[model samples]
Target: MLRSLCTPSLRLICKPTTRCRLYSTPAVPKKPNHALGVQNVKPWSELSTPQKVVVASKTTVNVGVILAGVALTGTIVYYIGSELFGSDSATSVFSDAVDKIRKHEELVAILGEPVKGHGEPSRNSRRRNRRITSQVVEDANNEPHMFMRFYVEGPENQGTVMLEMIKNEQKKWEYKQLYVDVPGQGLPSKRIYIERK
Candidate 1:
């Protein structure tokens, strides 16, 4: 029994493997006001249009109304998509997620390093019984994946950092895979695969 308990724990160090990081991606700045889910998409055929015209204007108006409606609907759908998934064409999720984890300062300190990036968050990791904020999404290459960055309070009272990214939709942040600069962990970070404490 003493031998089993006294066995040295294996210490495995993971290397960072991507160009993204907590402070490198462009995510929305933490804001007092924020946008959440989808809005609305109105159909075009229901719009008001003249029944008769001088040169078959009814068809033209109908077509025009349909197109306009489509455009409007498309815009709404896109907005909702981005909100649910992530920003359509920006990198801000990192910043947002980091902020939520409560290690903003540590993440910021690592940003100045020249060789830093996000890593995989552990599978079942936790700190102080709190859930870590995580998200997984593909890189700019359109790959399907995610990278979860976890923040925990260590025994020394310092912040503990870990990252993980999974391609499965079962993971979090499947929609938004972008990164954001934060002030928690160092740059060139990787994800971990631990469980909740």
Candidate 2:
């Protein structure tokens, strides 16, 4: 038993004289050689003419789609930039402001009043001294408008003015509201609105 254990390979074979040749299993088939490291090898047989034509057509279609997409994107970008930054859009608000003043009859009536051109605006002197100055100019729309600068001369005064445009049934313009520019705070800019005392 010790001898048999010592020579397990011999015991596994049918006979020692046979040298395990008769009992040995068949060798495994050799793996086919793969060219993992080789380069420039044909990966597949050449495509048939019809297959080639199909591939070419697909490539052409893909390129055309890509180009069309690029063109469309460029066009959209151009349109957005032009509309947003164009002079017309930039000037529209200023023009609208002027147009509102010019078209509104009430606004004209208010601003047209004869205050001494050099005199400060009528405001309380105790709370805060106020100096109101105005100038007329044409806006982008070529409409007459007024630019006002106000200085608050006292500590207690604050003011602001609300300016808006209102059109009548006939589309005639009017200034809709008036408010205060803070006394002596920010630079005052108001569309002139005058009320008869």
Candidate 3:
């Protein structure tokens, strides 16, 4: 048994050798056009109508929102500026004070030192000219301090009035120099400076 294990067996050496091979079809060459891997690109004009509409609507909405934001920001700035810088905002405040003072009998009686001007307003008031023409003249120099001139077709203050008013420490306008430059209703242009007596 030791000799048989050490030596090769004659039956095993007589076996025939067999070889195995794998066969496959050759790969075909790719098309010349596909070799570069070009992609289809469409121009903007070639886009469908629905796609164009969607793009246009998006643009319009974005622009509208931006415009609305600008307007709102402007309004807020104006409000804040009017309050903070009340000096230049005298037109509204002074005009309103004039109106309020006129409505009060006690305050109107306190008005003193009237003005005398008779020549058809001198045709000098830019307000009178622009108002009659219904046109606006951007001339701040034309308007005087605390002076409001506008045209109305009713029996309002027909003539010019110069008023001397002072705002108290409490932000209240006190009638100081409330004199009419041009008196309305053919009333006296100059009023006697009333003494407290």
lDDT for each residue of candidate 2 in 95-187, tens digit (9 for 90 to 100)? 344444345454344344221111255556564333444444566766544444332212233233333333345644444443333332355
Candidate 3's residue-wise lDDT over 72-111, tens digit each?
Answer: 9999999988855655354444445446445644334434
lDDT of 1 by residue, 16-96 (tens): 553322223234465443366554533565444542332347678889999999999999998877766673222354444
RMSD of each: 36.3, 17.3, 23.9
Off by over 4 Å in 2: 1-45, 90-190, 193-197
Off by over 4 Å in 3: 1-77, 80-88, 94-157, 183-189, 192-197
TM-score: the better of candidates 1 and 2: 2
Q: Is candidate 1 or candidate 3 better by TM-score?
A: 3
Task: Say which candidate scores most in TM-score.
Answer: 2
Which whole-number lDDT from 0 to 100 does residue 73 have in model 3? 100
Model 3, CA-based lDDT: 0.44
**Whole-model Cα lDDT of every candidate shown, in order:** 0.43, 0.44, 0.44
